[model samples]
Target: MTDLARVRAAAERLQGHVRRTPLLSSPFLDEIAGRRVLVKAECLQHTGSFKFRGAWAALTALDQGIGSRGVLAYSSGNHAQGVALAARMLGLPAVVVMPADAPRLKIDNTRALGAEVVLYDRATEDRDAIGAALAEARGLTLVPPFDHPEVIAGQGSTGLEIAEQAAERGVTAADVIVCCGGGGFASGIALALEGSGLRVRTAEPAGFDDMARSLASGQVERNAALSGSICDAIVTPQPGKLTLPILQRLAGPGLVVTDDEALRAVALAFQRLKVVAEPGGAVALAAVLFRPAEIKGDTVICTLSGGNVDAEVFQRALQRQAVND
Candidate 1:
């Protein structure tokens, strides 16, 4: 149900709230990818991720009476912090259900942002059920991570920026690669670029590539494993009902990248672009850097979706760059 109009409306709502992340490029990165590469440093966005854009849009779009009662959401990490901080800013109480295995930094950050955190087992438990129960018990409106129309519209605002920024740089046509989980971000961008020359493509971690598989098979598919990948920020079980349909109609074939590739990308982004990228946030950059065969055209733009990484994980990623050097 999300379209360009709704995305533009969301951008209007987000005018003063969210940061318009910059589009960055480095000659070293360009040489590595064998093409001109532009990285959208959304890792610098509020809460250290692009999730803030959607969180703000979704929470603000809610009915005043309903939102004041509180809001609830479930996410591995990025979305949790986004919703938590947005709720705090709006003077609304928030309860976030996060997987027990989510990065410690994200869990602690959510709590520090003044939201109550609930931990759940991602494999043996259903986060949706837990969130729903909590929401019903507390009279809280649920702000979904990616499935809702408002959230998609909020995320679509990223695409609007990409299109305009690319134009300023004289990039009339290129591939826009997005790090996709439930397809909300990618689908939103696709909708925003509906008639633009920039084509949207999705990138995912290898084992948790439900979006890639779904795009390949032309049907929604689920990932077999849930808690193994380091890209927890983007490890969703399946594409959302609303997101999948939009992607199926608008997006190009999805690309899949490995954990090592993701980590390497995190390191490289830090070294080359001086931007810190968490594993999930680096997948799109990984696709552009390591999976060059799957990409096309003379130019590519990708998002560094988040920077909410644990110290140890970030150290590991950085060491890879040191080892290579």
Candidate 2:
């Protein structure tokens, strides 16, 4: 299981490999939230997402002889790119099983990072089955997106950074909002921030708010749709078995934001913070900006989880924001 000690160890492993993403704030964002808002720009991390931290941590933790055989993963985009890039850097082969409808930019980028890409249908195909078969046949290690202990530990390193950074700013108590898909990222942070005066809250796209519903019911809930929202990066069937209990124990009530709100956040992030945040990445920021009544205290921290958006999608977000302005 992932804990504070495991997270600390992962941080030590990731010290030189991972970039310590910045905790950014904008006066404009604070004005919108009616509070002080800080954005953790994980979109600036390697592969333009926080997944790189977990990927590197998981790969490096493996026995050298086992790692030499290569790695395999299934993701809509961000995790695939993270694993692919990490594998390339480590001189190991990678194979990614992705949804056929995933952003083309992400698919191309995965291949460019030297991973063999396998596309599957999100509606009919079982990604796990495909990945398992490939891994078994090729003797490849599976790098789970959110369920594994080491992966969660690696992701928790972000929470460590948040804790340190918030203290540096003289902010002791605040909500640490995260764009939660399968709960790994949020759960990891929750573990890291335990008793640190910073609490974690999950954010999800409105139609796909399984985490929010799951938190409310104290049991796992599944999303009805497989694909529809623009926030693909943080979309998953349900919270992970390993990650849910941690979240249920440590996280605050979950928050849900509409796709439009996410797009607005993406645009606003680009305009104000001068950072690019894909829709899924911006969901936590969207919750902070548009769901103010749900959040407590005068200060808030949220993550911009990834920036692997397609150019057309990014342009659309910017155009909509322009029209609204």
Candidate 3:
């Protein structure tokens, strides 16, 4: 499990670097779920995702000399933009290796932040291997998306913000839900909640339910089947080695929702809450809507982790919502 002290240190380290996003109460969501619901809008964060928190924390935690050497990373989208923006802020060059199928909007945003983009086929090429080789060849520091300790520590900052915000609002023991991909964000948030009164849970897509399975089996589980979902950002086949144990220890329970449900949540966020939530970001809300009994407490906080959906995907999600209605 991630140390609470380390998580707090990361929060302190990133004090001025990231936004302390708003925690807004949603009456509609509360009525639907039969509980008080607050949305932590990290979707409004820098680069339109919570990944910036971890990226900034990891990059800033490094030695000043390392920053001078530049940084390299492999991401499907969000983390790529996070690292790119963070590196640019620190005057460091960054190379992000992304899947060819990643959303064009994310790619354009990363490039706009002055980072080099290297595209690879997810089927035929191993992105991590390619990134590692490039890092070794260029003497660039490699920033693993969810596996690195610093990255997790950085992500914990979001949890810290949520905790403080909740406390300020007099919410003492709410259930905090976050969407999980490789479990970095969930683990980090749970670490931040350690010793606090709140409980933490992870929400994931049904197609990529590795964390949910791993929690149940008491061992790490890897899914070889690669399926597409609207929540592409949280489609990791396995939990990161560093984040899995932390999540298993801290997170309350794992919840899985279908792609249709995820898209519906996204639409609900946009229509009812007037918030732009990417499909991955909306999974936690979907969990609360679809499986309310599993989550205890009158108060619940769901982190809207990103808002980087492409126009095409967003339109499709809207269409799905119309059909469902």
Clashes of 2: 0
Q: What is the C-alpha lDDT of each candidate?
A: 0.91, 0.93, 0.87
| Order of models, best lDDT first | 2, 1, 3
User: Which tens-of-lDDT digit does each residue in 205-227 have in candidate 1?
Assistant: 99999998998999879999986
For each candidate, C-alpha RMSD in Å?
Answer: 1.8, 1.6, 1.7
- The per-residue C-alpha lDDT of model 3 at residue 222 equals 87
TM-score of every candidate: 0.95, 0.95, 0.95
- Name the best candidate (by lDDT): 2
Off by over 4 Å in 3: 100-103, 121-126
The better-scoring model by TM-score among 2 and 3 is 2
Cα lDDT tens digits, model 3, 48-167, are: 999998898888888998777899988757898899999999899999898889777767777899999999998999877898898888888988889888889888888888988999
Pick by lDDT: 2 or 3, better one: 2
- Higher-lDDT candidate among 1 and 3? 1
lDDT of 2 by residue, 141-178 (tens): 99999999989999999999999999999998999999
Error of 1 at 107 (Å): 3.3
